[model samples]
Target chain A: MTPNTTTADPLRKAASGIAGLDEITFGGLPAGRPTLIAGAAGCGKTLFALTFLVKGATAYDEPGVFMSFEERADDLIDNVSSLGYDLPGLIADKKLVIDYVRVERSEIEQSGEYDLEGLFVRLGHAIDKIGAKRVVLDTLEALFSGLGDGPVLRSELRRLFQWLKDRGVTAVITAERGPEGQLTRHGLEEYVSDCVIALDNRVDEQITTRRLRVMKYRGSAHGTNEYPFLIDKGGISVLPVTSAGLSHSISDEVVSSGVAGIDAMLGVGGFYRGSSVLLSGPSGTGKTTFGSHFVNAACLAGNRAIYFSFEESPEQIVRNMRSVGLNLDSHVTAGLLRFESSRPSLFGLEMHLVLMIRQIDQFDPAVVVIDPISAFRGSESEIHATLLRLVDYLKVKGITVVFNNLVNGDQDDRNEQSLSSLMDVWVGLHDLEANGERNRGLFVLKARGMSHSNQIREYRLGSDGVTLIEPYIGPHGVLTGSARIVQEAQEEAATLERRDEVNRRKREFTEKKSAAERQIAETREALQREEAELLALETVDERKEQILTASRSAAATRRGATA
Target chain B: MTSPTTPDPMGEDGAEISDDGIFHFRLYVAGQTPKSLAAIRNLTLLCDAHLPGRHKIEVLDLAENPELAAQDQIIAIPTLVRSLPPPLKRMIGTLSDPDKFLIGLDYSRPTS
Candidate 1:
């Protein structure tokens, strides 16, 4: 039985302090068992080994022993120092021991009685002296060359593996890869270790990308994809691709799209808070216009906002929006809105991502706008992968995001659709000409949880801001730039003859009434002279009534006798 | 100097106390344990010899300062480090060979 065999469960596993690699390997590398890291030169083999030992010594409190078969101890320390690790200082602390074993097969002969017993003895002595729990054998390829024969080297390798296991110290044995089918020399050392990891430095279509994959891990489950990784000043960072497809439940708080009419088109008149929206259009097609409206509206609604601009600076954006009557100066002073503008080529893609993450984490803006994500295509090496990573990072933090994409004049592809597919909502804008002029048009392609108006509404930008008009060309044709439909309706109302005829008749009637008023005034003057004649006629009528009354009185006596 | 200086109790051959503010000192031992004790003794004598008034000497058993041993990057025991007076220097192996120590530290006799 091995010295640490009684535990059955190894308590001294070397925790690879990488972000997602540990989750893939269950806990970490098997404790006190040799693990082989096979890769080509410049594929991060040395870095992986050094990071393992340094991170173990610094982070996990596990003292380490590094035996370099290639580089001097000083060179290794200098190389890893740029990654923010203090290797020289740790060496000074005695918790970590580094030994350089230089092997030149040409100078030293390998006979039938060759063995690595002396090397093992030094390693064991160092480990005991410092009580090291982790060991790194930088490259075993040099040792294999010294052995000369494959069978003999293989036996020696097997013996060395048993020795490390018996000592109960987790070891990392690194080797350079061979041509094609095998990762390391003859694949002998990999088969002996409990875990095998292969790193690749590949150039595809003239674009160089580094990928890491777990080829095999005995009695364990691990991620199988070749994950993209970045080597920066802070050491190597791997972008775990598996979490890209993970699902999350969306929040239910209502958030404004900055325009009341635009929100009215949505059934709830708003979007779920923390949901991502995509505003897609062509150049000068009001993508930034829409985003500005959202930012201004968010500011007015008491929500802090951040706008990331690639096409224009904050001052330029403010000046342009001023022409459309959006006053952002007060909001800028109020500290409710922050506009960050930069040329995309100013930094590498990951640096931009890290900067954005850092800024958002510090500012903690409620709303974030990336004006025209397509600009990232020119700035990033891999557009879709980088955007997906950024989106994942934002979504994990539950930030409300708005992405503007420029779809160049009618040229659409799977990548555009993929970006649009990532959004919780998609708003498409276009310029259509109908009748005889060009008019602006808007449509909502999709809103995941809310029902929206499916009709293409016409809109006009005036002093009062964007106004949605009834579709003059009705639901079918292009409203193109001139707004000919509106001009046609105006011209149709102008060409009515009945209205002109009615106005003419009303004018003639008013003239006749004025003429009658003049005639009546003349008749009133003549009536002053006719008043005496009329009074004489009234006296004659009164006498006739008196005579008729006298006759009736005489006839009444006769009628009484006849009755 | 006005005050009469004390003689080094742990001094061996080739160790000399100078008049112009320089102290030459040596320690003797056999193995790791004795060497550690000798290093501590020799550091104390030198600290007292050169920095008479305001100085403190610390003795670290290598077995105890095992970490300190690694920190100083000590491969052999009974190492003496001249920490003060600028350009800190160290000598190992119980400092038994005083000529080598003085020459290694550039404090040998004046040729005048």
Candidate 2:
């Protein structure tokens, strides 16, 4: 529901090659409208305008004209040569044309009704000569100084803008920051077409930082904050915090956190390949050790990894991790791991982000680890926002990130909670005391779209890198260190004693049964002997009676025989 | 509307009905804008008072004859060009001031 006049017509746009600028402006500046870029000297006003023209000529195949009122064409070429833009090549290829508009107020005479017809004619001729779709009037204020102040100046300025618009050429007009609510000293702010972009280069505490703000953009919705920008060998790049919406494709591919035990704690044996992981712990809780494990694992998998250590230098990190048995030098030599270590305060927070992103893009790392993001001494909210942006960027590119942060208290780092909320896996590491022993414990607080263990494992750090071990859960509570070892030993001793007691009782019962069997056999032999003696006595008495009966044998012989 | 046959209001000062030296006047205008109308009226009055019937005033509507403006190098509208004279003189803007108009048209003074 837009009621704008140009809204009815399709808004033509020119793509500016500066990083994050097009995203903020919703696809670059409005086409055919004069965008006034105002800022102080050395704020990259000229660079911004020149980069726009050069990028247009080289990338879009759109020829452009650069009408400079300040620098000569040779100086302009030399100034931008360091950025690797081939100004002469573009000119030779008929993609770019530069014109030096020399103006001197002393030589100009305002007699009779005189229009700025000469300028219009020259500009029109230049635009037509190259079929330019883009034009840059760098430092339009210089022309104002050359031509002394008058009503004609303002009207002429308006006419020039109108002429550029009618010619349908996208124009970038630069001006110096005027004092007290003015866009330029000449007060030709009203003459600028639909957009006004302001550049800021400021130094705080001996640290220089550049910022870009889109003051106004008609017919488009643009990011309104002062995004910190960097002007290095790559030219101007603005780090926009959250312009990247949640449109990145979801990946189910699991990647190890480099620690097998830590992977076991995750739902899918590892984290999603294109997810963010937060390893927050108090100081000396093996945060970097965990990060190193991830980096090492990534290298082992033949995937690239970049470790940004704000607390330690590259050599120091390599040496320290080597002491823990994590040989990062091999990975570095193999070009699989890049250790980018610098002091957190070496530059502003935004500069660090730019450098980090540039490195990531160059290295094309699959995993990025920022060991202890809390080392940045910005405000709490600022740090949180920065972390969110970093995590968001890596995730969008499907680059897994393991951010190690140190928690100060018994809980998760308060400042990192907001960022932690967006993390796919939040593994909080903290030093705990149990059974008169202190040790580090790691637990997965949350793992979206997967099942993760809720148990906290003792995080053991040694020269061979980090390992997780089960803690003692006994009547005295979860125990660790020598106390846990002692308790486990005691339990083992009791189990052995139970086995020994059962074996000894069985042996005693077997020996008693054998003794009882011998005694019963002796009793049976004695009873059999008594019975034999009684039977012999009875036979002897019967024999004597038979002898007496033999006297009367004749008659009893038959009976005896019968008997 | 006043016809050429009608006597001029400022006849007592200088007004005659002779065509010996006919002065020609051409006023360029896009349309009947107030400024263009003013320039026409002012130029006509000056011509009538100074040269009376000896001058012929012609008005060119540039809206109808848009291509004619380029010939006299007319950047501003309501420009007056003295084409009949050997050496052409030009004036821009509404010719409200008669003295300036006379000076622009190379008219020395009216000989009453």
Candidate 3:
């Protein structure tokens, strides 16, 4: 039955304290209510219940009582010790109480009518002993095997749930999953109508992945998707991708693409901070080289970085990056860079996502590089879903992420296309075959929020680093490699011949002009000499004639001179 | 209740005799409920009929000491446990059926 709270007033939730679980449930399980966790054997139902109690005790200051019907108190404590749960310590501190109710069908004979009041007494006593706010009845269905009165047991089980609610303790009741399509073996889901969570441990392609789903939350708007959860040394972590909605704050800052040439292509000088970049290319197209460059740049900036190499080991990556002038080993030594390498086939897509998230959380890196993410073997949709979550998570944390995907020729473009939608930047690498040579080409297919170059530049990976050479674009289309070299050479020779022809024409014109000038000078000089000689001869004749006249006209000459 | 010094009717059977040849029965109940009273009455009658002057009955009401319920691993109320015998035996519910109750108590009939 639903509580008497007003519909407009939201249901109060008790924080489960499980990582990402609160976010998925929008808060947590309903407070002061029982949540049935049903799962098959080895699916981690007991562990989940224990985590709820332990987390409540340690984190929320909520004392808890664990009434296990299937395992003894000591055995339960021993079982959870591997998970680093200090059950004994909690018990000793008066923060928790564990009561193992052992019920054996052959140990007692039924004579008349009896109820499970003793169970209530034991549970009640333990709860009161610690003032526990949380209670866990692990696999309460064990009663079905230990008792035979079906109707009486069912009624008492119903009363037990009601009693738990009346006591106002947030309870977690774990049950065995029933046969096909049923939520629990005894249909306990019908009793605990507040919240129901189902855990599944499935093996796909030789890899086992554990998943948790909120099947029903009566009064809460919870994430209904099956979230992948991981059980590691740190306990269970659920990867609730949908929890990190598109509401995360964005950053206007930019981080370099690791390679200057790539940064040059991105008009903003780098990718946006907290943005996702998809780097896709065929095999041997230097995808890892680009990723390494980004990581190297991040580490160089004194920012922590994690490189998830799905195809190469850390040592191998360091060695290979050395050839590209990226010294990742030093960064690793400085504790600024970390490498997590594992085969894509080693885990399911969700498991890989959880592992990556865990590593990222632990490292708290400013940048993350999943080199050759296309190495992941799964359905296209599944891979897309996994990447979407990963990108969402990284973006929410404001951590720059680069995904290097290996695209096999043209057909693999479909996979990249589906994932590219989630990326803030997409750099496509390809091998251009020309003039009997294959040259690497890099181009920015898309870069959101910044104007990026669309031109495909010739990418060269030398010992120094990656350089983006401007591809020669002529009438015959973009040319790279030897073809570009040959085209450049031919253009240089034509320029040289044109320069020589212009020089020869200029020399001939100068010679002709100088010869014409010399001829004109000589003619002018001869003409001047002839005029002078003629004037002198005339002067001599005039002087001889004037000498005779001069004697006679001396007197007249004086008067003519005066005039 | 009779004292244990009195002779027992079927004491010759070695299986029914303990170190003191006295039957020790501890009845666990929640309170003075009808079932608890009936269980106590029925068990007392069965003891008197089968092993007169050779039995002792002790009643433990869980309502008075709820914490003691866990000591005997008691779930249902009106649980009768035979503690003094070599082999410990327990029977749940009110002892309505005498034959079944006797069998649960591991009591053997004497040969004529």
Candidate 4:
């Protein structure tokens, strides 16, 4: 093979720490191919690339080399250490090489020909020394500014990419997000690389959001949607929106929600074990009350329970439930119940799922309660798919999860219905206003395997906790919720009772007539038996008289008569 | 005819090449009775070696993966598919002619 004419040998690929990401990019980064990750500052460009390298070394056992042009190695390590990534440890183990190449353009001897040969040498040495299969040149924007003119820098960059590719090491070259309509400072890196990923951070309606897009991946299909990510304690976790295959094993054991009537209405007296139950209602409709009851039941059954509160803090929840008569503090202290309280805005919805799954793994709870799933509605609709995955993850762990949804107004929340299909049971709490007061009504909207009473039960939140009353049923229908409905039902029931009393009197009259008929039949049988006895006695008398007459006619006949 | 144990010729493409450099390939075939597996392997080997490196030889034994025989496309073992390098090509059974394989890969037929 002639020099510079060697056949294009296949490049070694880099592995994405993300599961679906690797699958999308066949066999990882086109081994030694220069992939561009361009995004604005604070747009997670550095985080994404670092996670890629860190996950490669830690998770995939592929050593990596990180050549940072912007931040110092210590700062990078400190920033990411909270995300459960031990960057310092990886460096200590010599599995990762972090090279901070600070370029001072002012101090450079610009008079001489500028070449990246030194950088190439250093990068090569680091990669070869560490046996690295992956390389990340973070914030290549610094290089553009460091090298005065664009022409030399562009050519050098081109050569660098080629050099990396020829060596067959996967490389991630990050560039800063530029002005509108431009990807980076030079805008040429996007065209040079075989794969391009664009990250973005924006505040929509005062809500901060982060999203990532695989702008291009040559020869491979990638998820094209704007995947929302979170800068959380675990670095960055992409929500692989796609389902993990539709083979969720169904369960036959119906699990109870601890409410007898609710379980009864659910058809099988409970939901299927490991199934999800959605408690949907408007504010103050007792979503928490129902969820708390369930958690209490799970804990009482010797199962650990985890309550994720998005609205109320753990302390506030504990205090508030005191009026409902639930002592969550004891459970928490005992470690049977874990209260994970965070604002809905604490992290992206996927992060919520990840963190919840993490907490679940840590606590290994048998029951998980989300006080109100609606708290997550602030996230993009794309999160719905991720939420489904989270639900499945919980179910697969045999954890009975309860999502308390606050159904706003009378919009006939579709979220409840959509989630109900995945859930084993759904309880709807309605707040009805009647008789100058608001009363809560609890109804089992749907329960898959259990037989639950269809009647809406009236309930009240009081010092002792929630009181569920079997509402009166009358001629009109079964009453639920407020006192007025109950009173009207009671009045109708009174009318029905009056009507039943009259009917019962009429039945008694007919029964008396039947008794009199039976007495007459007995008297007739007595008369017949007396008549037969009298006939027999008269026949005997006739025989005796004949014998007496015979005796008088003939004394000797008496002996004959006796004989 | 060469002995059945003879190794397939390797082409010059750094891949094992055969007599036909155009269809440079090698298929290590052990036995006969082309089932589905045989058909796929044969076709792939043919394509990897013969069709612009598109034709590759794939050998399949009838004893393993027994269900391969049911396919209508493949009637025998060791099928080959020469997909690339233009005029796509295919061959069945133990591919016999190196000249034919090269021709399939768009190589000029060697004057014998």
Candidate 5:
């Protein structure tokens, strides 16, 4: 008996057409089958269903039937108009149908053995009228509450699901999130469907983020993590960051760090074209300045760049950077550089990531700068997770990313340390003080695969941009700021004092030599004069000795006395 | 009120099974599944015991005519619709339990 292998499961998929959603699901919802999208209030359950139907009818050329159990047709259309979906027009053109089924438990009477044949007849007729391939039973559980709980209702729902499947129509049935781990308010809905997508709106630190997770997909593989989704003017956009693995291509070409000295510090005269750089520093350590330089350098090279500022507004960034000679206005005018500055508290980290990723893709920047990644105030693990995803995504795309992180104390900042390895080059900028003045010190913490310089350059944030001072060193450590000037002056003065002392000692020795020469000449003259007088006395003594010629013995005695 | 009505009295074999003197039972099914065949067989046996050729059993397959499912207000498969009775009674499911079935149609069996 050969086991049947002809598509035994026969899995088919339908693209939901929601951005990043299909990628996470590996495809869309199961085709020609019912998929349950469950969530709590205001979690975009209704909008998601509407978007699916609208996108289906518009993009896939497959007409759809929207059987709403909660909202009226007009309200649905009006509420979804902001997303630019023309439901009424689609309905008029026979591309879509909207049927609002309102059930009142108080006004209805259920005789014995009565099933929901009316709903089936209506749904069936609607499906047949348009030959629809897509169907949405929004808030399908509303009927359960209206009809009361019974086996008849449950069995009828099962029949309805099977009937839809048998008719070969892919359907989306939405329900309220049930208690605990239930996918739907009524547990039976998920069992009858082929796929179940759960939406959750979580608020932490007063910032809310909508996340989507595929609880179960019967046939196909899917992302298990709860991917964060955004509901803006356009609609829901899921950020499948982690699902998009690190399979993106790499680049070995070198690019400048915008500052020449900093580029010199890194190997290859700059950073790799797509490598990630972390410019970490304390507050006001010119992290933003370095970011501006990168943007400027990228734009000057005729490549696009996007700067996400979590601490300042766009105008404020432009205005602040103007003082540093980084004229970003022209780049903004030329559309080569984009500045997206938003307060970190405005949204959750994931939403910011969605916005950033969306902007990055739309702009297709060659370089991306996120100033102060420290703005995320989630749990340590959460921040790490976000940054990890951000780095991984940018790296895979071969888009160079520079994240400016601020570290407070000398202690190892876990947040910065956690993301250090993902960085291809980590440049730590510091606020160093030695002699009553603050200075900026920069060092390459690590540069992967590059023979980067190990010297710490004292950088200057001047009116014309970042410049690295010479590696001036002294006994007081690396000299910088006023300390450098003061030490140089002190050294110069000490050298001059040493020269003056040597010159004074030479002058005193010359004066003493002339006086000693004068003294020796005087003594020689005096000795000569005395020896002449003694010669005269010796002559007189010779005359006296001649007078006493007879006295030879006396001369000998005189000689002996002289001796 | 005791006499059953004879409306479109057609049986599975194109013979008139009811002529106002017979109880009419329309057993709706979705083709030849085991459950549908079992329902037809059980209904025929019950009718043979109770009415002794005084009842007409008409079997309708929804698979052949899905549109007819709407006409008979049929939702669940393998239903028994007693159309001829003054007060129309509909019993859904495979009718595996004869006691539940008889009681569902407002009938009492002779002492259990």
Candidate 6:
């Protein structure tokens, strides 16, 4: 009995080699123990098991044997070839062996007493043939349908698991999910108690998403959340929400917002490197424009950028950006920018995330932009979770990301409030309507660890790109659009009129002073003339008196001498 | 038993004499276990009473040739595969019940 043992030594794990799976499992599946992969039909259980085997053979150098009870060996080889697994090559190299176990119930009759020693011998023989350290029994539950006696099959299955454990080979057993919450149809989960992983293919809102969750891991701590997984040509990749802790290293370096005005508003010159920035607003608020500006700026600076366009195709985005004088096609040609466009309803939110992450990993971009992330068709929580993981992943990689969100008029505040906490900078865009015109206004709502402008700056989209206009603060209120323009015009006219009035009053005062000075000059000239005339009269009288005195002076001179 | 059925034309080596009216049985077993021994004894007794000289039994031990387990698609230890009755049939067990064993082999009991 392999009870949950807490020993000083940790449980050793064999790396599954699937992307993001090891990180979530804290390493990988338990080594030398059977792990039950229970899922409904077509949930990729077989693919998951085969990937484990193939990756073990090629990557980890551990040989594996696949004992299939459902699919034939050739068919399995053909099916996984699309995923680029060279099963035949692996077999030729003696690194892998495939045994297809065909059980026909109609052809076999149970007589009295029998055991599955034949199965054990076949499995053991296959294991020894390649000296395998890993084994995959894909859909082992087919034996239950092939064999009639349930009690005997059950006991044999129990023993088979024990035998596999004694062989010390890491085994993965795929089982069909049972009805009504049972983990497996044949209760195979009971036998493989070391690890149990459940895969789910759920259709939400007409979109299918595949998710994986580790139900139980004995003596190991693993991520319990259902991580979305993608099965493409490259094989299965689980998108684990790696936000186990907020431990990603931050950068003090800043990245440009592409638009100079927007950068100025952020006050830090741009967004912090590796920080998430949210561009949220109502429709037609230039959210995508802002995101494109950032992408264009990043590409211009020789940093690779990925623009995830959910609503528009790459051609459409390029064409639309052309109207704003942003030539993104050149960047695409230079391979400095990549545009990944998909309909939001193409798959679930998690699928979008997985695809985006896959592209990001391939491109190894320095910046990422999700244009209109609100275009994704999913529940709020699912979108939130996807964004959370995406943000965490980008931050961990030091990739600056910009998320464009389109909020409806009424739900603007609520939407911002919901996603605001996850962003390092929140730039809110809105349509300001006044004076019978709608103008785009942009404001930095919150910028963590930096000072940002709270004032809304009116911006215009033109052939030269986004142009920010200084807000017009009037007596009534802060005005924007044509209202602000009209207010500015009125203020200019008023200033002109006041200057004219002052000029007119100064001219009147100068004229009054000049007129008074002329009057004083005239009066002073008249007084001087009167004094000269009086002097003339006095001189004439003195002349007459002198004549009289001259005549009397002769006589008075002698008397005067005596006086 | 039905007058010894043509006086036992075949040799003691149990070689295939002809394809017509021949019941060639191949019993696959791991080793000389009790179940394998029981199945061999029960099959011999049933064949002698029912099929008489028309039956041939071949025992293949998987312990000696383990590769045959996968080749013959064997899962149970004491498995009897009837190859020459036209349509091949497989029965797994010790064959402890005679009536059920005969029915599984599609053989009718001789009415005396």
What TM-score would chain A of each candidate receive against the reference chain A? 0.74, 0.83, 0.89, 0.77, 0.85, 0.88
Query: How displaced is residue A264 in candidate 6, in Å?
Result: 2.5
Each model's C-alpha lDDT?
0.69, 0.78, 0.87, 0.68, 0.81, 0.87
Query: For model 4, how does the per-residue alpha-carbon lDDT over A1-563 read when each residue is reduced to its tens digit?
Result: 12332225443356787644565555565555778888877888888888888888988887999988888889999988888889889988878988887655532322212345446656766787779988998876677676564676777777777787677667788988778888887785644558888888867545667777888876556677776666776567655444545566767765667665566566666677788888888987778877887887778787899999999888988888888888888888888999999888766566677677768888999888997788884533545676677777876777888998888857887665567666767778887665577777888777765566778777777776777776776454555555546677777899999999999998998899899999999999999999999999999999999999887879876667887
Q: Per-prediction TM-score, please? A: 0.64, 0.72, 0.87, 0.66, 0.73, 0.88
Model 6 misplaced regions, further than 4 Å:
A1-10, A242-244, A410-413, A480-485, A513-563, B1-19, B108-112
Runs in model 3 with CA error above 4 Å?
A1-12, A243-250, A410-412, A473-475, A486-491, A530-563, B1-24, B51-56, B83-87, B103-106
Q: Candidate 1's residue-wise lDDT over A1-563, tens digit each?
A: 35657137644456887655676676778777888888888988888888888888888888899988888888998888889989878888877888877655533322112234345555766788778989988887787665465665677677778888888888888888888787787665544557888888876444456677888777677788776566667686665644455465568777888777789999888877777888887776678877888888888988788889988999999988887778877788999888888877655454455556656766788888998787763323366666776777667667778899887655674567777657888888766644555556788899989999987877667665666776555344534445554556665777666688788999998899999998999899789669978999999999999999999999989989987
Candidate 1 chain A worst ten-residue window by lDDT: A106-115
lDDT of 3 by residue, A1-563 (tens): 54633323448888998988998899888888899999999898888989999999999999999988888999989988988999999999999998888878887787877778888888888888899999999888888888873898899999999988878889999999999999899999889998999999998778888899999998889898999898878888888876367998999999998888888878789998999999888998998888899999999999999999888899999999899788999999999999999988888889898888888888999999998887888888888888887888999899999999888865657887789889999998998887678888888899999998888899888998898887689677888988888889999999999999999999999999999999999999999999999999999999999798878788787888887
Ranking by DockQ: 6, 3, 5, 2, 1, 4
Report the TM-score of chain B alone for all candidates: 0.49, 0.74, 0.81, 0.36, 0.73, 0.78
Per-residue C-alpha lDDT of model 6 across residues A415-455, encoded as one tens digit per residue? 46778889999888888777777878888889999988878
Q: Candidate 3 — which pairs collide?
A: none
What are the DockQ scores of the candidates, in order?
A: 0.02, 0.03, 0.62, 0.01, 0.07, 0.70
Give candidate 4's error at residue B66 in angstroms: 62
Write model 5 residue lDDT over A46-95, tens digit each, in one string: 99988888899999988999988889889999998988888889999999
| B64 Cα displacement, candidate 6 (Å) | 2.1
Model 3 chain A weakest 10-residue run by lDDT: A1-10
Docking class of 5: incorrect
Report, for candidate 4, the interface RMSD.
28.0
